[model samples]
Target chain A: MEQKSNKSLWWVVGLVVVVIAIYFAATGSPNPSSVAGKTVKIGFVAPLSGDAAVLGQEMQKIALYRVKQINEAAGENGTKFEVVYEDGKCAGNDAVNAFQKLTSIDGVKFIIGGLCSSETMSMAPLADQSQVLVLSPGSSNPKIEGIGKYTLSLSYSDKKTGEDLAKALSSYKKVAVITEQNEYNIGIRDTFLEDIKNYPSVSVVANETFPKGTSDFRSTLEKVRQASPDAVLLNPNPGVTAENLIRQLAEMKAWTGYKLFGQLAYLLDSGRAPAGNFTEGMIVIDAPNVNSPELLAIEEAINKDQGGTLNDLGHYYTASTLDAVDLITSLITKDGNDAEKVLNDLSRGRFKGHIGDIAFDGHNFVRITLSGKYLIQNGKAVLQSEQ
Target chain B: MVQILIYSFVMGTQVLLLALALFLVYSVSKVQNFALGAIGAGIAYALYFSISAHLQIVWTILLTIGVSVVLGIINFLLNERLTRKQEHLFALLTSFSFAIVLESLISIVFGTDGKNIIPGILPVYEFGVFQIPIPGLITICFGVMIAVLLFFFVHFTPWGRMLRAIAENSFSAESSGVDSKKVRFLVYIVGSFIAGAIGILAGLNTALTPTMGFQLIIMAFIAFLVGGVSDIRGTVIASYLVVLIPETIIGSLEGVSLNWKMVLVFAVASILLGLRPNGLFVRESRKS
Candidate 1:
């Protein structure tokens, strides 16, 4: 009788455990197939907060503006678009969460953005596995092309930017390279180095990589000053390192003699740039200016109809978001209810975008000819004379 | 090299504040307060808002300390109520939960945007090879002053003696008419206030963010663990060593990255911890 009672108690406990587990599993897990409507939902993931929040916020604002314009233009049949903005936060775990949430909870068929290259790289695998058409607006790292065929970028690749920079500095016989020892910085530096190799006259006199978030660049500056190259290539993005490097270079009087060549990271807002003549002669490679007359006209029309300025640099992100929306609309317009067909169309088609015409290679690499190298003159970034 | 040393001194002020907090809690209450980092982050956010709005720095620092003290008191009360009968592990879990709560609250309130504090004080000195920002130098001097004040308070005061007694034997201290609970509460409050001050100093030195505490917490933990948690002098020495040694070693490496340098620190710390569970300076007793 005792043994029978014990077995009954165990059975009850097991049933309770199973019921609780089932309840949690059902409630906690998201349903991914619930999205179906006239309005196509596109997910936007970017680092909306943290150290890179400024850039992320700009991207978010731009992306939202684009979606509003598209929805308004549909004028009842323009294929109404729904956008879900998720904060990637520029961290691996957060990127994964953003990807998972967009895919599962939102059931977004397409995703745009992921501002930082780091976040994009982290989200690439999840995007590839889920077969979601992932488009990055600001991620410029070349390694992103290797992630999968589903990943596409609106920005110029590191290699292309490097080659452009190399061409810009081709006249200089001796050059010094100082970059942060991170994947992104190293990628740009390596690409630039390789491109410069083609020009035998340009020999890298000094190659140095400093720690990111470093406050003092005196030692690094001293080394570069000693090398006394015709030009110095700085590949660190805008933050503590960039600020410190510029300050140290100015302090050491290296700015007077050597030309400064930097990556896109150096083209910071007016406030972050150094004071006086520190940035006058520096050149940087960045995305093509979308503020051109042709682009501005389109932006003005969009703003007139949609009530937001396309002149806003952040609107570039919105343009990228719209690209995703357009891709989805085109897909559905062609073959409704066929996700496979939509993915295949995206994989095969070439679309003219805000940056430029974008088409994916078989390796999932998006080729865009929007890369332009600019020089800083009087605190303004102007396209290089050659360009 | 002078610039590196100066930067290390500025960095050390922040580390010293964290070390002092950890030292107070461990030496007086026989507990580790993981919530120090969260408190620091919270205080930083508060100071950022105050400074941006053009409020007085004095008022801001006071408010930050007041809020931190309240949080510490609440933490103590919760630990007393929830885990008084439990072991050290349970106390640690309680502190960890409080830290998480503080972090999440900051995230919810601030929304995770990093705020850059415009330093009120400007750079006062610029040598040929180095420049010293007045605010950072002030922070270092302030740390030294606080350390001296804390030393005197702990060694020369009656409350300090009572705190020592409680730390040595809470039951004995309670039996001898010293209110152990009161001492514990006070220690927590003081410790949190120190953390708040450190947070403000860090904000002045660098940008403030919700997750900044995570990085500071690791450095603080290393400083405290290496210093011998219960020894103040040891912690101060360890703080400088922790910052300068890794920085120099990492600086010396030709191609090895900062990420790898961090890994090396963690590896070394792990080995040290394995050999000396009580820390390098403090000896662990076999009997509780």
Candidate 2:
């Protein structure tokens, strides 16, 4: 009996030790030399391989290019940067897992990314607790404004886009709206409805909400068609959902006679939506980069190197991502790895970005001084008016 | 109201195709084939691949239907092998695992970004107050034809009567010279073939996503349960009721949200099932 007990005790001890070793191995720390003043490790979380991969890939390419240029121009005492790319997959749970891996395993204090709103929102609480600075290039959900002091965005909030969309559709007395259920889209929808209420002349006749990844809008479109609204507002993330909605609307014959209005996602120009009568005459409200000659030239050069046009979807996002890299690099150079100080410096500093003067308000949202209501004519986005 | 009815018919037909396919397998094999959706999705992806290669639409669909038959045979063979080992739980899980594997393979080959099977917009047919897309109209017609053919085959044909015999008592049917294995195999093939047709119609109307069929199966099961799991005919009737009433209600009401359509479906199914545990249309004395 004594010998049997001893054997079981030995097995238990071995199993515990094995488990401990596995845990440490799975979450092992980065090499100390990588962050010991030799390099600035910036953690990145983006949808690298999923449905939203096109935007993430573009952001990645632009960030890397900007980093290379910055590092090449730096003198002695300038820190070389290393970006640890984690695939967020544009979902909340995946973003949290990626965030934990970067902060705990990589020990990265400064992070850039979470291109999608769901990605950033999931990482916000953790970033706040760890005092890690998170500067997102594309998350525009208004709810993100209060996530954390450490959380900031380089793009304008969805509030502005929603208001702009409402104003553009004010001429139509009765309008139908189909919105995807996502943090960013929900924010845009709430604000758009709120703003549209200001114009009593406009009344929303039909409103429908579908879950993310929904492709069939036939029944919903039928509902909208039954209402015979003057216009239709389609708020879908830029990709398959948007294209499917447009194609199906055309199928239902609901595409005709309805003035189409969309948020910035439509302006990505991803080629997912075919260039024809369906896309023609559609008006999109997005941040303006039409007046930025210098940035446009840089984007042209990058596209040449990329061997593909990367800025088909709003070039403003690519520009913002590059600016984020530049801003982080400069902040680190000035404040040396202190996340709080770097964030403070970022808030105080003003810089000229591709989309015009880049400055954040007290809540860390970028202020938009330039925007455009673009007209889709002959498959190309033409600037109709600048605001 | 006419527009709502037309839209309901189109949408309900789409659901019925999947439900009846599930019903066919369940009645004979006593196995809830979760992979039915994945089988259809895989064939749809094949159709997309063929179209992308510039094949004619007719050739693409025919080729994909061929692929569906092969997949159905493989699924049934695997179930048969597993059942022989008395691994009922494993057989059931195999259906789910098969679906995941198929979806993963699709994601790898076609990519996570969804594809539009049709190259361009399809025109709509308008008559009086009703407007229906060409694809939607075709789907309704195909749905009716398949349902009628299935109903007649099950009620009047010898092979189908043997299938019913196997469903009632497999051991007795086997002893009476009914080839139970052959009947099950045929059921899977026919079911999967119809699944393939529905998949192509759905892909044409909406778009193709790796996870497209997952939600569809949920809706199909809801119809299955509501119509009485054992009665394919009842399930077919319930499918239209399940999709149409809620959709039309949500479509016509000004303030009602589209998201509630599923909720209404779930609620209707729950109420019907609670009142009739054997199924709203299922006779307690029926064998299946």
Candidate 3:
């Protein structure tokens, strides 16, 4: 009886293998191009549904619109572009899985996104190994600099903004810093602290850090307020976390008598400003919202079909994302859709984009560090000046 | 220092309220209502909708409480049906599943982005060196009132005595003609209402996230365990100790990381429990 059972088990195992083999044979290997045509398929990873879904979905919309526009105005080469989207959920592990699925199953060479810094960084190692090009529209963590040869970001690093903010706010004698414990926010916090140290007058009165997903920060803010800092730096990623910091600061009654300073995340949207009057006159330092006539035309085109302006969700991100796509497509156009050749060309090329004249240094770091000073006036973000 | 104490009191009240709410259900049902936080999150979302719909604060509060009562009744019915055999672990699992479902439902309705019911800088009233926000003051007052009311209700009221009787021995309470099921259902409604109130207070203090109540509930559970899990007074006291010590002493330190707050909580709990394995508050007679 035992011998018969062993033989049956072996037969079952063999049958399962045969079934899987037959299924794969019948369904053929995964293909990048959804359709049979001369198409350059690009895998797009974005947080479709999660904490950062609003921003990610908006990025997806812009990417799709860009793809559609490219297809509509197919160049002389007749190279049609296709974007296959996978949800990264604005998380690390999810992005790794998405990256694996895109490269292994979808078989795409070029990819766009991993909008969040963590998502982008998680996939950097894999992308670097696979020699896949990852051009991010949103990741701004200082650590992402020289992460990989194929890894490049359209957004300016937080290191530059943090140092700029430190110098900008150095006039204040005392400053309190509240930061999120994420790679991106931590990068800003650390850089800001390092630069602020150079100014003897600017003593950091309180430096508080909250874990990611922590919305209740009243106590932390209370402690910060107790220090009576002349200025406060609230650094967190845009979306819920930033909004919470702003709102909680208001609730702690810590908004009065202190200069509120923020970074690029705060510049994403003014609707996120604490409603009524708390955020009035607050200053945020970010990349210049460089919009040209051509950029405005693209925005108009996008708004026509997207039912809203791309800047409604994210201003810099939209411009940078457009730049990312344009850069990739331009590089692909010049280099014949080869990922390695595109990287080589991008390393040596200076491209003009919607965000302005964009160029990468030898290490593929964006060189145009033009920071803009945005003031919250009338509950809206307006560019006050170029810093 | 006064500000740190104010912070502790305000934050501790939130934890205490949640602990008391959990204690109410646990004492009666011997089942940990893991959905306590989800129920609160649901109410917070309700408050968010009401505020978005331009409802007045008074109306929003009423609407939230009403929604919470409905949710409580649903929970009571579900728990009654699920644990008809009084299987504690099965009931806990059912509650956990219910929590996940409710949390998902909240996420679907509210989206994952956090929202503030009160979206502005709150005015602070200063009395000498002590500065207190209106919401924090309100939370403290409400917390005190609720604590006093709970103390009186559990000790003096006939229904409270019935609840205690059921907690001690449900079979004996039922033999004495006490409607244990009815009393348990009422406890659920009250506990859930308090949880909803805490949820709104928390929202008013900060912002509303689908998982906002998750940390609060975890802290409450820790308080329950540390406080002997069977003593009402001990749970109340433990909630404040667990929150205040870590938040004020550890969190307010200049260089100490906020990550250590949880570590400190567990360390303190371990120390106290190691000294008294049963619990900090368990009576010697009960152990025997």
Candidate 4:
């Protein structure tokens, strides 16, 4: 009985080896191109949890929705795409691990995300080392401009938003700054401070940095108010913290003299809703609204699936993530799962999608950007001008 | 300076409420019920939603109490199981795990976004250079009331003595016919109620967060160690010390921002602990 069981096991092992050998021989490679009617696995890394979870969840929904659209459009016998998601937690260390696992273990040649700047910057080295192409949909850290050959960001640089914001505040003599001590906020703050130097009339009277999760910023607001600035730049992480700061600052009736300015975070209606009308008239400098009939229609579908990501996270991220998915899937549909070709085409090609006609143009990051001026008018953000 | 001082005390009161919650459970169970923060957060969310549903204030308060009691019962069971075996570390771990689970549930239910129990700009009263929000004033009043009441209860009342006796030595207290099991259960119930009230106040004061209790619990624990863990009086003083010291240091310094606030507080705590290992007011036991 033991001898018969051993013979049966050997037969099964031999049959598995033969099947795998035949599969490789028939496909001529371990992973066949999309053109050959094979499934392509794409890795997605995003916050998925932590403070930036809303953004990450929205990005994930967008990716999954877009992939589903592509798969549906592809039809039977066409190349199907599968997305393997890993929670980056919006931290550098966590992103590196996610990137490593995706590249080494999952054998994913292409990955989208590390939406937060820290995630993108940290994964750049590993992505380059593993020869995997990383396309970031939402990271805007100016430092990410030339992160790596394999890493490319579709999102606008903080340098553009900062300079635009500084230019917007050029009329003010005394500007107070309250920056959240995080990668994304730090990037915007440093850039804004540097650009504000261009205007000799402006002087940052109060520059304060608060740690993440500092809910009680009443003292921070009081300190900033004491500076007596004509304009105050509220540079904090988006969502809850930003809403908290705006509300706390607005609570002091006497602290209403200064004009409030924010970055991409101000574009979010959900973030500002808690403070009610407090955030009205606040100027925001970031990506201009990425509106297109095609994207708008897709966003509606995604909102149905994710409940309210498009409305909660707003347009910039949703548009960028949609464009990212379109960019990669198009590249996969054309050149197959070749990371080298994808990187090359991504850098040089002017791919038209949700965020308009854009490309990297031989640069590590995209050359085209929609960073512009926006104002909160009557409890809703309106694009004032496309800079 | 006045405004900074006002805000510091406001934050100090929040830490004090959390410390008292910790002290209540620690007194009898001899285990750090870290879930007190999550319990506070969970109950706060419960109250906020109940109020949002347009329930009457009385019903909302009653619902909040019911939720708090249920949460307290769950927390009691979690600690009671391990604490009976005198597994203090395991009890702490179990409570910590419960804290994580509760926070995750809150996040799942409410999302990570901050919700305002009272939306828009809060009303504030001016006292010369200091502008104090109504909630802050209320918090300060309540903090003092609870601290004074707790101090009196533990030092003067029979029930308080029973609680303290169990805190010192549960086995001996039990041997002396103290009904320690019942007392510990009662302490957990009271502790959960306190946690729930603090949660509501904190949610009203600061933007409600899923991890609000987690942050408060850490601060309370530090104060618990800094003040003597054996007594509520020590915890009260240490809460003010831990909160005020960092606020003052950050306010006074030019380069040091609120980013370094926690680091400074931790350093100050380390130094304080170094000076008094058993805590500020806890004296060394004389073995004669």
Which candidate number has the best DockQ?
Answer: 4
* Candidates 2 and 4, the one with greater lDDT: 4
The clash numbers for all candidates, in the given order, read 3, 1, 0, 0
What is the per-residue lDDT of model 2 for residues A45-163, given as tens digits with 9 covering 90 to 100? Answer: 88875667777877877877788777777755567888888888888999999999999999999889899899999899998899998889989888888778888898778888888
Please give the distance, in angstroms, between residue B97's alpha carbon in candidate 1 and its true position after superposition.
Answer: 3.6
Q: Which residue pairs in candidate 1 collide?
A: A62-A318, A63-A318, A74-A78
lDDT of 2 by residue, B1-288 (tens): 677778788878988999989888877777778888888888999988997898897887678877998889978987887654657678878988998999889988887776877667766788865678788899999998888988888789997788788778778898999888888888989888877888888877777888887777778889888888777678888899888888778877867766677788888788877777787677666566
Worst 10-residue lDDT window for candidate 2 chain A reads: A29-38
By TM-score: ranked, best first = 4, 2, 3, 1
Ranking by DockQ: 4, 2, 3, 1
Output the lDDT of residue B180, model 2.
83
The digit string of per-residue lDDT tens for model 3 on A1-387 reads 999999999999999999999998999755443332367879899888766777887888788888888777875556678788998987889999999999999888888988888889999999889999998888888888888888888878888888888987899999988888877788888999999999998899898887777766766777787788999988877777787678667655424788988876677663356645777788988776676777777777877877765654556678888888878876675566578888888877788777777778655457767777889887777888875
Instruction: Tell me the docking grade of candidate 4.
Output: medium
Q: lDDT at A11 for candidate 1?
A: 100
TM-score of chain A, all candidates: 0.77, 0.87, 0.86, 0.89
Per-residue C-alpha lDDT of model 3 across residues B1-288, encoded as one tens digit per residue: 667777778888988899899999998998888888888888988988997999998998789878999989988887886555788898888888888898888888888777777766666677776677777889999998998899899999987899899999988999999988888899899989988888888877777888888878988888888887678888888888888888776545887656567888888777777776666677655533
* Residue-wise C-alpha lDDT for candidate 4, range B191-280, written one tens digit per residue: 998888788888889778899999998998999989988867789989999999989888877667899988988998998888887878
